[model samples]
Each structure stands twice: as structure tokens, then as C-alpha cells.
Target: MDNRAIGRCLLFLGDVTEPGFAKTAFGLRDWARERCVGELRLPQATVSAGLPQLTCEQAAAQGASALVIGVAAPGGGIPDAWVPALAAALDAGLDIVSGMHVRLDALPALREAAARSGRRLVDVRTPPADIPIATGLPRSGRRILTVGTDCALGKKYTALALSRGLAARGADVSFRATGQTGIMIAGSGMPIDAVVSDFVAGAAEILSPAAAPGHVDVIEGQGSLFHPAFAGVSLGLLHGSQPDMFVVCHDPRRDHLLGYPASPLPSIETVIAQTIALGRVTNPAIHCVGVALNTGGMDAAVAEAEIAAYAARLPYPVADPMRGGPAFERLLDACQETS
Candidate 1:
């Protein structure tokens, strides 16, 4: 059967400590459920996609083609314990789809298993070999980049939702994926985080190339400008994309940077100022259109109140993309006003 016809596979949920890293599972569930057969979790997974549990052999028996690693590990390296389970999946007649920086075939056991079972190891994080340095040249088209106060807030979701909203208004818009999960859903994108440091800006420029003057490219963001470890990727993308406008994604519940207790998250105002200062290097007219709050799993009334408070004081529209209402509509309106 063709790969597309292979349908769902057993999504392998490993021991990913950070809840955000497990976002790949939820992304596939929401955007590409047709490609998911079931889920397979290791012993101590804290997060889940809320799918039926199934082993590799059982998933293959159900006509599942591949076992996709559903975690976007921070360092992009595979865990030592995961090798055995991946090898087992290969032996059970399931291909391995990994978006990690580490290639599956690099592991000796997985290599032998794939060779014996004739299964494939797909690596999606490979960057293009011909990527060149960013030119900083002028480009046409409107662009909205979803920035964040911290990593894994609501950048990708905001971009996707905003793109849909723009399309509903009959505007020419496209959601540009910049991470592994977004790429998986969109079918193609450069994994900005995996690209070489020297070429990340170039890769980002290629990811969302120049388009018609009226067209809009809603580029999904990665990492955070305040994040100590991953901020480099974010800056590269910001400068390369040359966004005309941006939306700052935030979660009010968390006061500090996730996983980095010492580094407190920056305020949305600071982020807006910093982005304008830095992004002007590429696009002098870059500005903030709105704010997208991550109010997922919050009480309806509480979420509304929280958004209302932000809207009352903030100069820009503040809304939760997942809970679109008046505030979100205002955000959409603000985006449309950007020239």
C-alpha cells in the first residue's frame, strides 16, 4: 500500500517529561487523526493524546503502517530506553517515522531491525543542503508571525487558527510550519530548530518566500526570545520571515519559563518592544497585531474573565484562539487592518 494509504499507526508516547514536547501527539490528533491508528505509551508517560492504547503488533494488525515518535525532545536526541521499543516496532512490521534530530537508522538495533523486516525509517528533521545565508533583501506580501512569552505557549495554534480565520474572509493566506509537529500536519516545512545555526535564517526565508502583495503568510513560531536554550532559532526566524505583524502568545497561569525555574518569563510588553527593535533589521514596519492567550482546559467563565481583563488594559486585542469569541474576532479584525 502507498504510504498515504497506510492510514494510522501506533503513536509512540515515550517518557517525555515536558508536556509541551508531547504536543506532537495532540497536533496529530487534531489535524491528522486519519493518519493515527491508535497510541502506544511507555511506562511513565505523564501526557497522552487520549487515544485507545495499542501495541506495535496490534496496531500493525489493524493496518497501521508506521509507528511515529510523538515527542519533540528538547535536545533532539533519542532516549536510550526507546531503542528497544522502536526495534520491537520494526520487527512487528511497522515503519518508524521520527522527526528527531537523531536518525533512527543510527541506532544499531533499529538499523538491524529495519534491515531484517524491510521496514523504513523516515527522518523529517533533515534540512535542505542548498540553504544559503539570508540576504536581508526586501520581499513582498503580508506576514504574521506568532511569537511567544515562553516556548510552547500557543504560537502554532494561533497561526493555524488565524490562517483559517483569514481564509474565511476570502483572503489569500497560508500557514507556514516551522516545527516538527506543524510540518507533520502541513505535509512539508523546514524544521527551523534542526537547521545549522549559520543557515537557520536562510532556511526560514526559504520556508515562507515572497508572495503576492495581498497574500498573507501566517508563520508558526518556535522557541522563545526569553528562553535561554532555544532563543537562537526564534531570532533567526523573526529576522528571516520579515513579518509585517506578529501576535504574542502567552499563558497567564505560568509565571516562569517552563523547565527553567531561574529564568522568569518576560512580560508581553517587553516582548513586543524587543521584537520591534530586532525585527526592524529585516522589516522596518513590523508591528504587533494582537495577543493570543492559551486558555485551554480553563473554565468557560474564568477564561472569558481573564481575556476580558487583558483586553481592558492592553492596547492590542487579547484573545484565546481556542476559545474564539468577541475578543478573538477583534484580534482577527486587527490582523486584517495591518498593511
Candidate 2:
């Protein structure tokens, strides 16, 4: 069936302060616009003037064929307020749609409400993964190192290092496709597509009764949480498989002394906080492994030391996996315990 037939899609933006979410939404909007999906809406207060709507009546008046409700992280479960707001959308004869970030368990209740009101609803996450080789499903036994979105982000190199480092230590590791080119593998090399395909097949194998649980795999995420292009598929996939631990890569370039103009990247604290929040939202027990020290500085030692120190203060253990092999091993061991 041609699933592209979205009768109407109303985007309900959540009030996630994370930059990655905003970036992802913008990217989704652009992609949807190209596909002619539907109208996208954000809460008035959350966005700009004349865009606010306290009820579905306003949305309907604005010619919204579907109801998209924006929310912050669904705290304490689905908020009490969403129930009525959704009801109003149904009363207005509109389909109710939400982002994929919405908790999976909450869908039934929202669907029931939509059903009662004779309205349809769906989560418009990840755009249906039409990539020829991409299944958009979680694969088991694949040790994945998902990188945060944002260009020049060290996720690609970091994931590469982790995979190589693990392989050298006799741990079979697989790199998930981040849709990027020019990734180098230490051993027998394959394109990112083939690697992911193999990993998916391996995951299926692991799920079989004859398969074991010790297989390792890793995947990379494409955009920062706030980058409009950031669709957190890697994170979702990792959570689905309940990976041993999540290793976050950080970059430290101190151009502050050279009068470098401020870039709009989120502060390290913000990134870490959002990551933790995502971890809690997905799987709380997932260990957080930190890898820092990018060589993009005049004083590599100082930069590495500074970032290493900063990473140490966080809730997770921070180390230079490239340099501190022993520490990296400890982190890997910890991730395995949870797996």
C-alpha cells in the first residue's frame, strides 16, 4: 500500500528545550513539505504570535484538518491536559497525530480517544524508513555506538574508534549506518549500508533460540537533538535493543582565546543534560559512557585535559577511549553487564 497517503498530518511540537528536537522538527517539516504531508503547528506560547491555540476550535478555524499537540517531555505519564485537548480535536473532526518521541505506552489511550471521536491518529516518526536496505527496526546482538547529531560532530570517528578498539580486544563489533560516506574500517571493510544490513541479520540471528546474548553491535545517530535534521533513530534503536551502555563523544575546541565568534551549539552541560533526559525517557538503566578529547586545538594536552575533567563531573564516567584503553575497557565491561 502507498503509505504516503497522509490524509492530513498536524504536527504537535513538544516543548523540548533541546536543540536537537527543534532541528529534527525543522528537518521533518522540510521533508514533509517536499512530500506534501500536512500542516504543521506548534503551540502559540511555544512559538510566535497569532499561532497560539488553547483549543481545537481555534485549530479548526485555522483550517487544521488534523490536530497536532505540542508537549514537553510527557511528565508523570501523559499530562491530564492532553486528554481534553485531544478530545477537542476529535470533536472538531480532526485526526490526532503525535511525534514518535511520544511514549509508546501512551498511544493506546490516545488512539482510544481518537476512536471514540471517530478520528484517526498516528505517530509520524522517522518518515517510514523507505531506504531500500533500512528496516527501521531494532537488531539484537549488534554492538552500537550512536553519535549525536550536528555536523563535524565526532560521532563518526568516535564510533569508528570504538568499533576498532573493541575488535582489537577480540570483541566482535558492528557499526550501524549513520548515512555518511568516507568511514574507514580497520578489518574487512564494507560500506555503511552493508555493515548495517549485516548487523540487522545478526540481530535476527541473536533473537533465534540458538543465538547467544553476548554479540556486540553499534549504530550512529545523525543530527544533534536540536538540529532540525536530527531524527533520533539511533537512540530509539539502541533503547529497543537495550544496549549495554551508551558512549557519548564530545569535542573541545577552545577558540575562545583567539576571538572566535560564538557558535550556536548547545553548551556541554545542556547536551549532557538532554542526553540524560533521553536516557531516562528510553531506558533508565542504560549506562552512560563518555568519550572526550578532540584534537582540534593548539594545545592538545590542555584541551584533552579540560574536556576530560569536565566529563568527569557528570553522572557518567568520562574517559578518553582512544588514549585510556584500560578505562575504555572498564566502560565496555560495564555496558556488557547490563546487556
Q: Rate the local accuracy (lDDT) of all candidates.
A: 0.87, 0.46
What is the C-alpha lDDT profile of model 1 across 28-127, one tens digit per residue? 8877887788898888887888898998888988889889899876677889878889989999999888888888888988999999999998777776
Which residue runs of candidate 2 sit more than 4 Å off their true CA positions? 1-139, 182-211, 231-244, 254-263, 279-284, 297-300, 322-330
TM per candidate: 0.91, 0.44
Which portions of model 1 show Cα errors greater than 4 Å?
1-7, 15-21, 43-46, 61-63, 72-75
Residue 159 displacement (Å), model 1 = 1.4
Highest-TM-score candidate: 1
Local error of candidate 2 at residue 62 (angstroms):
66
- Per-residue C-alpha lDDT of model 2 across residues 1-339, encoded as one tens digit per residue: 122134333444443444333332333343333321333333432431123333456546656566544333423234554565566567777775444344423656666767787776644331223223323343344344444424445565566556666767787566543331211111112222223332532332232212145666655544455444333443333433344466666555532211224445555566556666664543454555655445543365675567557656766555555555455666555545543
